[model samples]
Target: MKKIFFTLVAMSAILVACEGKPSAATKTTEAEDSTVLVLFDGETFNGWRGYNKDHVPGKWTIEDGAIKINGGGAGEAQSAEGGDIIFDRKFKNFELELEWKVAKGSNSGIFYLAQEIEGKPIYISAPEYQILDNENHPDAKLGVNGNRQSASLYDMVAAVPQNSKPFGEWNTTKILVYKGTVVHYQNGEPVVEYHLWTPQWKELLDKSKFSAEKWPDAYELLINCGGENHEGYIGLQDHGDDVWFRNIKVKILD
Candidate 1:
């Protein structure tokens, strides 16, 4: 009888301890909850703020599950009157992940810290993530010099080949920027990594078109371009080609 009573008490104590513990499933859910994708969940416009409210042009829509930018809606091709959608908030040091696919011969870009420069064009102030159909785009002919091609810094730097994936299929890309280092990744692989203020980078900038514009510290472009946003908006371009973007998300790291 005493043995039976002791067994019952021990079982009760074990049950109480188990009840206070969190299950493995609960832990996995907590980890997932910590990560948040910034892009819209569905083809619906849920997490974005329109660019230039009254001046927003073009027809921006969600088709099947992606954000589709139909050309000839409001702004002219490569013009200032086009439409742009930005995240509700701004970030400084973070990791941005998204999937994108472009149409034949089309051109567009994702700009980080893209803002207005007093005297230059809008793009001049913003750093661009080149989006294009490399096989069919004109910029591809320029070889390593053109920034207008796929994965290049839109006239600033040429993204090494390993960084760009083939066209048509969806490509997963990531941009990690922290302090003086900026790295580009394509399809989960790192292609090019550069330090912002290195002499080699500065020499390239000095010889590049950036010198003509005249900024005291040219390398400052990376830090100063996105005016109000130290970590600026994530913008998509309607390069007149049938480009599509979806599965956009971001995680801000302090």
Candidate 2:
């Protein structure tokens, strides 16, 4: 009888100790309850449009659960006509995740802090997270030290390890921006990280194609860029090749 009584008391004590504590599953549920915006619904372009335009161009389409683009031509191709697309909403600091795949020889990019000038393309003033077929694309061989390859800061900084999967295979990318610091991840590995608007960034920009004398358009657009205003649209480049993107989502950080 005493043993039974003791057991009951111990069980009661345990229950009391756990009464107010949340379980792991409950914690996960609470975490998920936080605000997250779905940029691409996998079926329609409910929250995206061409830069400075009211609608996405004919070359961009929704197919097989992916936001696909297949008409723009490669390198210096008629960009003003096929131009890039931007998220309908602008974000200052946020974490974005998406899955993307490219056809052989395809080249494209994702841009952040992207502001659309009336007649300029997104890349003119924004920093790009390069998306390219390193094995086949010629631009992959043009930038200094792999800076133009997949997951790079596009001509300004190279992603270490250059960890891009082969063409036709989907690669997951996560980009996080908070308080002027940015990071890029490829296939779950962090490959690039940098602080924006700092002296180092300024130097990199000065040496990059954005400010190069040979690239007059790029140089002019970024000539006066600064951090006084950092919030802007998220963009996908229409680089005149077939590319696929899906599962696009973002969480704006406080």
Which one wins on TM-score? 2
Q: Please report, in order, the local distance difference test score of every candidate based on alpha carbons.
A: 0.61, 0.80
Per-residue lDDT over 1-254 for candidate 2, one digit per residue giving the tens place of the 0 to 100 score: 34334544654455445655435456334236464788888888998888888988778888999999875566433554576899987788778899999999999999987777886667877889999999999999998999999999999888886789999999999988766667888998778877776777767778987766657776655544423567778999888899999999887665
- Quote the positional error of residue 31 for candidate 1 in Å: 6.2
lDDT of 1 by residue, 50-151 (tens): 554433344567787888777663245445545565565565666788888876666777876555334433355556777877788777766455555677
Q: How close is candidate 1 to the true structure, as a TM-score?
A: 0.72
Each candidate: how many clashes? 5, 2
Q: Point out the worst 10-residue segment of candidate 2 by lDDT.
A: 22-31
